[model samples]
Target: MISYRWLLFIVLFVGIFATNYLAMTVKEPLAASAAFTLMVLSVYGLEKFYNRGPEKVTDERTDLINMKAFYYGSLALIVTLMFEFIWLVSEDYETAVLMAKYLLMPFGAMIAVVVLSKAYLERVM
Candidate 1:
């Protein structure tokens, strides 16, 4: 029997292909809507699969490793976002604000969450 992980992989693979095909052939607004919807649903599925516990889906050690990896990934995302924001600011204040609004805050939030979670986990573990 195919595992749920493989099922999730298959769904995401198909979603990516469908999104690419639809985006190229469809109207921009429709394509954007479709992509957004697909992304939301994909994330929902992933969250349900990975976030719930006691299933041996992953152990405490694995979770700690994953959290550590997330912390690093968040760091990278925030650093790149800051550089982008600086470049945007050099270009124009209005553009900088617009770009930073979409980029910096979300990345910063993720970094904070990951860093704190990793710290807490390390302390307890």
Candidate 2:
């Protein structure tokens, strides 16, 4: 099983190598870098599925704790979304669109966290 540290190192190394390769071989490197990021994230996602561990008990106590953590995480995500929204609104439409593109991943992650955590909370609580 690949541990977190090794996964991190592998992603980091591939990112650096891909970036350097693009810099040396391509006229523009942004697309290559962005592609590398998506690739790395995809790999990490596959790793999660491949290395998924055993299930645990879903008792009320665990649900309560998880619910609290989800609430806090949601609050944090809300704050970040607010900040990004404000920043996006302050910019021109083109700039706002670009900014939103960068924010999309975190927003999606927050949505996933909320969905999964609430699912678990509802299942137990």
lDDT of 1 by residue, 1-125 (tens): 77777878787777655554554344243553455466547756776876787766778787875675666566566545544544444445588678867866776777677767767877777
The prediction achieving the highest lDDT against the true structure is 2
For residues 20-115, write the lDDT of model 2, one tens digit per residue. Answer: 455445523455446455655666686677679986868777767567676766766665554444444433446757777887898788789778
Off-target runs (Cα >4 Å) in candidate 2 are: 1-66
lDDT for model 1: 0.61
Could you list the CA RMSD of all candidates, in the order they appear?
Answer: 9.4, 9.6
Q: How many collisions per candidate?
A: 0, 0
lDDT of 1 at 100: 61
TM-score of 2: 0.38
